[model samples]
Target: YYAEMTLVPVLNYLDIVGTVKRHLLGPRARNQVDMDFYFKGSAFYLADLYTGMSKVVFLCFWYASIIPAVYFLTAATLMVHYISYKFAILRSYRAGPKLGAELAIFGRVYIFPLAVFFLFMQADYNWSSFPFDNVCETNSTKVTDSYIGSHNLQYEYRDKDGGETNFLDNIKYPVEISEGDSYFKFCNQDMYNHSPKVFPAFPFFQDDESKWMSDDQAVFSWVFSILVIVVLTLVVNSILVRRLGASILSYFKASYKPQAITINQRFSEQSEISAYVPMKCDPSFLFPLLLCDISDIDTELIGWEDARNKYDSHNLSTDVIDEMKEDNEDAKCYCILKHFPPKKND
Candidate 1:
């Protein structure tokens, strides 16, 4: 059970990678196993998504009560990703973009936190079931001992037959119980006390279970930790995707520079124009194209020095800028406000 919980994700990931390679590289590479690229990509990603969802459901075996808010949120996230990828595959997504490399990347990155999440879930579920045994009897001299209490009793394992064995050197803490009629026998160590009254003590002697965390606390801690990881993953991925997409678009934009210049030259010949740089001009001049659906303010315009100058002259209150930043840390509003100081003329 322990090994399964630990190893299943790794195995699944390997399978997904193998499937992706086969799908992209063709049958000859994978021992004559032919598979469609779209089919393989969708299948593997959907499988991972299913496995993640199943892990959430698997937690129910340990916690049958009302599900934690985190559980619902996590499950919903997995579902959303599944639906999105499936929708893309069925409708809009093209396998030629990266030949299933994108799926493999997502599968590799997502499985890490997912694996950790399951580990926490399994550990939380089986926490109470951990092997523990209380000391039946002990005869050490001191009032408190390491295993039991300090008292004058020597401990030994007694068998069913009239034979006793003292293998104290071999045994470690948290002693393992042997099979058959094996029982612990404690003899009085103190010569003065001929008839010693041994006390039934605990295995690990310190009697404060209060120091341990309750199930609710453990659940919340685990859930909260997983939640933090999920949030960070989302935020970081969003930033990376945004930046990478921007770079790619920029490269493509550079590629069209010559064509744009040629079109502008033709337009200038037909009509009098001051600036013939179509790509560099304001978007309004370009056409009605929406790069971002955020208000009328183009996100690209935010990068323009002229627009930033205009914004600075507006003299928007610090409270307003602070409020925007407070609303969304990743909005980039804070960064724009920070870098573009308000015009002194205002």
Candidate 2:
């Protein structure tokens, strides 16, 4: 889904009927100044793109260990993202809205690490539940306990060995006291609950039915150890991935680099700067003029020096140009914006 959302926009360079876009909303395409007024592409949403990719990242990390084939699917999805976004962001989209570094940085720093921890927990559980020649469904009460999470509501003194159980009518749910020690604990539950199955998962070294992990053991300490191990793994993996991923991207996406400011031709102040440009040499400014009924405009006053209509539009452009600049100092530097009238029809 993430890959699909990403690729669709990049590929949708042409609105064939040319009606989806409006003039004032979203980022403008590079050549939109020449395209039909309603045909320009929409702005790429970096935040939404990040959210979608993060969903894939989190899901991949959580389930990859349980089903090893998920590794390939995740790889394929991300690979699609890599190739599509690489081309689209450069060639298809505009320079785009400026975003903070933390927009991308937070997922790697916090989200990925937590995802890795979840991955470890899943991996540990799956590794232990192996050699599964014998498989059977758990009890219907537990299976049907979807919307009403049963295990969370139950209170008991025994180790969490309660397996899937039938919902006997008004029967007090049996709670395990010890290893398979099944008996009803008179707790004020709704007589329906999810009894946890005794799977030989983490924090318990299974010897026999003689012992189990209950509230008496140092469970927090063991959990702390697991967290430490997960952090260490993330640190090591991050170091390795940084070097390897850089080489990988460099190979596949040769143009992927720090978006450096590279100006091939610098602006010339004395010769090139101008408040107005004629349509004979440059026709780009004429695009805006075409949107209005220009037949009534005084054609003679367009380039005349007496054209006190110094600017147009929502009264902003002419004000700045006509303002008293900085207490009458020699105005050596100013933003030499292209002199174009704002859309009067908007």
Taken over the whole model, the C-alpha lDDT of each candidate is 0.40, 0.47
- How far out, in Å, is residue 23 in model 1? 7.1
Q: What is candidate 1's CA lDDT for residue 2?
A: 35
For model 2 the local lDDT of residue 220 reads 42
Query: What TM value does model 2 have?
Result: 0.40
Residue range 54-90, candidate 1, lDDT tens digits: 5655554334323445556555555554555555555
| Candidate closest to the true structure, highest lDDT | 2
TM-score against native, each model = 0.21, 0.40
**List of clashing residue pairs for candidate 2:** 150-194
TM-score top scorer: 2
Q: For residues 28-130, could you state the per-residue lDDT of candidate 2 as single tens digits?
A: 6456444433333344678766776777777787677657777777777777776666666664553454477877787776667667776665555544433
